[model samples]
Target: METVMGNGNGQATSGGRAANAPHSDLVLPYGDQRNDGVVQVSFTLPVAAGPLAEEAARQTMKLMGLEDPQVAEATAIGEEFTFFVGYGKLTRAVELSKLRVAAPMWEELDQAAVNQLVQDTLGRPMVVVGAATGSDAHTVGLDAILNYKGFAGNRGLEAYSAFKVVNMGSQVPNEELVAKARELGADAILVSQVVTERNVHLANLTNLVELLEAEGLRDQVVLVVGGPRITHALAIELGYDAGFGPSTRPQDVASYLAQEVSRRMLN
Candidate 1:
């Protein structure tokens, strides 16, 4: 029933928009009814689970600009921790057209096309060195992109004749990955890691870049990173050429490598 100035686009002055307003990319959280702006949120507080804790949760939601915050449940997790679930009506709308999202612009190619492109451009299989660098022992993400079996019914780079994949499994040091990439004359290097608390992987990913730069291989190799926590924007911010997040298929990586290597060689 009320409106406020919102973030992004600056046109979202109506979290609960008028019933007859012309729709032009304005959006809000929907719950029981259209334009209701109802949202559910769950969070844990350091206070003990009691009436005070429940009230604190409601107050927190109100502080977040939620109207009519209704605390649904409060449970104790530990000696001094309480978890609360609540419903609230947000009073801010977002203009979708003004949102800036960072993503890669590349043409999708199938396995056959990728293979043909590699053949036509390099006249040899593209060497790809992949590993789960640092103390991150997660290999499921790396294996899905580099292994022959692939993931989600799509064949990985190993199955593509265009790519010669050397998958160095989990817990590999950044030094080892760089060395392996150099030893094999890899055209691309993929590092996978699970992002941890305080973004511990940030140091490791940056360290890898530093190593590559020091080795005189940064410009020659296409550096890519992947994991559940990885994003194209984040990877680039960390000095990687590309980044793959969860649900990315092997074909996506292969196509990028094929096109990137081809483009570099051509230029």
Candidate 2:
């Protein structure tokens, strides 16, 4: 993706343009530097929708180093609350090259390798139970990961020769998921939640962890959560082994599961 990074004066470390020049179409040299001067900011503050509110929003943008901030749109989210979409040019650029995120990085193996790994490591097929738990009705994300066909260009977990994946579909309750895991002797539990409104997903995730802890299955099974807003930090806080957010690839999940299972066996 193309990105632009610059200082307040339009001067940037990027091999090109001023930090604030109208706009620059340059792909960030590094992941950290790719600050595509675009953002979808939303805020709810107690203010009336008027010139004063617009000015306040613009001022907020300026304070954030957004030059010539423009209030593109404004509306009322609820009683005594106002929302604004401010547009502006950012003066700061990120040093993309300095970023070092911890994540699985490996080429995906074919069906044969997967099957061989399962047979050699687990002495049988690796069983994984997945579901879109909580009140979330969206099944597309879970289906994309657990179904054999997969999503995008990546193959789903079920397509792996070594994996015996069972997708329980969506809207599964926590207790039911736990029961299913126990019944199926699942080695891993993959939970997906896409809805975040009112923090319902958080409650659901927390409950699942509690259930696992109560059942003495917390350490025995690899617990993973994924969603549009889920993060590794949040997952860890909720007692999950790992958390995945939007744009997570199937190979990434598969590699992590394979490595983690192997690691656990050693201990």
lDDT values of the candidates?
0.85, 0.75
Show how many residue pairs clash in every candidate, following the order shown: 0, 7
In candidate 1, what are the lDDT values of residues 75-179, reduced to their tens digit? 899889999899999878877656555555456898899999999999999899999988888888899999999999999899999988899999999988888
Tell me the lDDT of candidate 2: 0.75
- Which stretches of model 1 miss by more than 4 angstroms? 1-22, 78-80
**The best candidate in terms of lDDT:** 1
Error of 2 at 140 (Å): 0.6
Q: If scored against the real structure, what TM-score would every candidate get?
A: 0.84, 0.71
lDDT (Cα, tens digit) per residue for candidate 2, span 1-267: 123343333122233333544364433223233454655456655887777777788888888777777777899766666798876766556543453233222335555765666677898767899999978899998888888888798888888876789899889999999999999999999999999999998889999999999999888898988988987667777778777788877766786677667768878
